[model samples]
Target chain A: MVQEDYILEAEKLYVSYNEIDIVRNVNFRIRKGEFLGIVGESGSGKTTLLRALMMLKRKNNDIKGNVRFQGRELIGLDEESLRRLRGMEISMIPQNAVTAMDGTKTISSLFHETICMHRDGKIRRRDSDKLASQIMEKMRLEDTGRILKAYPFELSGGMCQRVMIAAAMINNPKLMLGDEPTSALDVTSQLQVIQELELLKSNYQVSMIMISHNLGVISRIADTIAIMYGGRFVEYGSHEDIIRHAVHPYTKALLAAVPDADGKISKGLPGLPPTFEKEMKGCPFASRCEYCIPRCRKELPEDVAISLTHRVQCFRTKELQDDIA
Target chain B: MTLLKVENLTKRFKKNGETVTAVNEISFSVEAGECLGIVGESGCGKSTAANLISRLQREDEGNIFFEGRKINGGFRLKPVGRELQMIFQNPQDSFDPRDTVLQGIMQGALSYKVYSNRELKEKALDLFSYVGLKPEYQNKKTSELSGGECQRAAVARALICEPKLLICDEATSALDVLVQAQLIDLLKKLKNDKKMAMIFITHDLPLAAAFCDRIAVMHKGRIIEIGEARKVLKSPEQEETKKLIQAVLPVR
Candidate 1:
């Protein structure tokens, strides 16, 4: 693809908090209308990396990287420009709907505030209500009157999640960031929310970066998948490449741990993911990897490419695949 | 032999000045050493049923028989002791924060007054190893352990008294995939080794298919379908069950 065709790009990005690097030396790019999924265990720094991409700041955090959104650097942009770009061009759906929204405010009040803030006097109060109702309908949420009058606490988790998605789509932003959007919901509600997200992507051409811990959830929606471990991506490729031709030991272990839809109980991966508290010299996953060697414990492996769209950072990717097969 | 029998079990609650039927006249039975799964979405009254069966909640109208004798609410005045035990989704919140692993587990055996302190400690250690926890974990507080480790500890605690029926109420829902798999394997092993019957409640259809010998599909506080796991999965008659089966991700 051409450079101008890319909607977002990251070059050698690193994020640190309290002098400990949480995201290190990462490079990424997403084409127009592309959906990228990042999968990792808890504390793998995927959430931190997602926040850094949007330039969301935290206390005692330091970020160094080149983040380009539509050919403009986002790292050092002024607050006023960022405010204009946030809801208009880029938006986020937070991790949990229960805590993300205010409990005291009604759904209609929140929607009115958002529409007025984004449009800045261009849309009248009556039109804003009409627009909000239309977006809710597009999200497949019936009973608009009942939903609008209800508070966040009155709605179920799934309804609250759909409301969050509707709020995110009111402006029709080009990019949407979802952090564990379906984790809190049950199976049926999860399917509904995922289908709604897929609809948003297809009908509105909204590109997305979805962060999740389950590969099953990611595989259903993502076009491209990245397996993150410790503080970096262990493998990056197309969804097919990552699912069928996974090379990294961590990636292979993750795939083997998920229960199948056909009711097959998978042989689980042994041991827990390591906690990265300090700077490390070698690969962080060496302790749990079954195929780890002396060299793996002594030095970090470089990214080895198997195809144009597939790459893995492992010392013995080929041998690991052979063993698993 | 039938270990537990419930006939016309019903529970109702008042919400916003309206009487909602949380569980509406459900009937089921469990055979000795058999696992029965109750699969449903939220507000389907699966948890309420479990609570009523375990005597954690009172049913408005129902008949519960254990060992061919009618029993009232469990664990009170009946001296059921460890005969019935329940495991919840979040074990961390259920535990006392100040208690150590050994203390938490011993509470089960201590309630019966059947085992000496030394015997309980020995049994607790054996259970710790059986559930895949190390010996050192027995001394740590609940907050010090990870979510998976705490769940494993909860299982060990639940089995320490050697219950006849284990009720797991969405016990693995809060865990990640890897931990969920491990916990299921552990539960399967325990069921076979101890010959214990179980009432497993969950929202995941595939998981119920894999874990239970028989499955019951609940919707709107009613059991719409009940049969062998394979039979129900192969030919689901209820629209709710079909929708749930379709929602599951296709396993590669």
Candidate 2:
């Protein structure tokens, strides 16, 4: 495939907060209209990785990355230049719709402001009304007139999330970044959000990088899944590789921890994730990894390619696979 | 023996000048040392029903019989504090921000005046270990602990009173999947070793099906489905329950 075929590519991406490295040497290539789901426990830096991809700013944040979006380098871009890409070329949906949205503003004005930001000028209220309702219809949020007039507090959390999705889609960006977009929702609303995302995939051909702690949701929706442990992708593979042919012990343990759809929970991983209080040297999962050998604690293994799309960062990958097979 | 029995339990709140029947005449009985899971969405009256049973909120109309003694609106005459305890969903926020988890638990236990200072400390330490926390965490503030650890602390706090009937309202909802699994294992062990009855309330249908002996699903302030976990999973009676079961997409 040509280089242009890839929508976004990352090379040796590293991010640290206040001199403490959180994301390290992450590399991946996402093709057009393909979504990658990143899963991890809290403090695993999944959210940090998403923000670094978009160059979102925070106190004492540092990013050293080579990100190619449509073959254009994005790491060194000026703020003004990056602003053009955001919400137009790349959109982000936040974790909490209720908190992310301004409670004082009406939904109509919120949409109007989002449009006005990327368009570089003021937009007519009538045009915002038309555009907001049109995309809201696509998102399956009926009663547009009422919803448009109501504040964020008035609408339910699910409705606010769908409205946020609609606002993100207003410019028809090529890619979307979501941070647990459906985590705060109930099952019904979560299914609805999934349906909306599926619609976007089919209708608009939008690619996404979504962060979720839910294994079930990620496995169901994501084309390629990346399992993050202690700020790095311990295992990045296709659904078949990670779920069926899992090589990393942490990935396997994460799967075992979740109760199945029929509600049968198996043996659990005993210890908690590494707090990273000591000097970083070996695999972050070494503390809790049941099959951890002496070498796993001494050194961090390279990301070994088990297949064309699957990568496992563990010294015992082959042995684990052989045992499973 | 029947540990708890609710007959015609109802709670209504006037929200925005409109009367909302949060829990509408829901009735169920829990046996001693058995887990009863109540599954529902937000505003489905599961939490309200729990509050009514735990005496956190007064029921508009109902009869709550605790161990065959009617104790609703009459909790003062027949105090069930030592026997009945409830844990909320957000244990982190439920705790006092300034106090350590050990202090909070100790204070709650102190309300009963059952144990002396030295025995209370020992029992708190014992309960802390029982809930799967290390001894050092006893002095740590609630803010320093993770969500799962804080919830375990909440469990320790609740168990300090030695409540035979424990009500956990969405206790594991805020944690990660792996953490939720660990907490589930802890709860199962507690049920057996401590001989405790639990009203495990959550919105997770499959979890309830797996964890509880009997499952009661509430919808729109009503009990839509109530039966054995296996029976409910095999053949659900209500459309709402069926939708909930279907809503859980299996992880491949």
Positional deviation of B153 in candidate 1, in angstroms? 1.5
Inter-residue clash pairs, candidate 1? none
Model 1 misplaced regions, further than 4 Å: A121-124, A320-325, B73-78, B116-118
Clashing residue pairs in candidate 2 are none
Please write out the lDDT profile of model 1 over residues B100-207, one tens digit for every residue. Answer: 988898777786888999999999999888889888888899888888888888888889878899999999888878778888888899788998999999998888
The lDDT for every candidate, in the order shown, is 0.87, 0.88
Residue B51 in candidate 1, Cα distance off native in Å: 0.5
What TM value does chain B of candidate 1 have? 0.96
Candidate 2's residue-wise lDDT over A1-325, tens digit each? 4989989999999898888888888989899899899999988999999998899979999999799899989988999999999999999999899899998899999999999999878889999999999999987788999999999999888888988999999989999999999888878778888888888888888999999998888888899999998888999988888888888888877887666766787655677887654369788898887788999899988899988999989999888888988
Which numbered prediction scores highest in DockQ against the true structure?
2
Over 4 Å off in model 2, which ranges?
A: B74-78
Best by the lDDT measure: 2
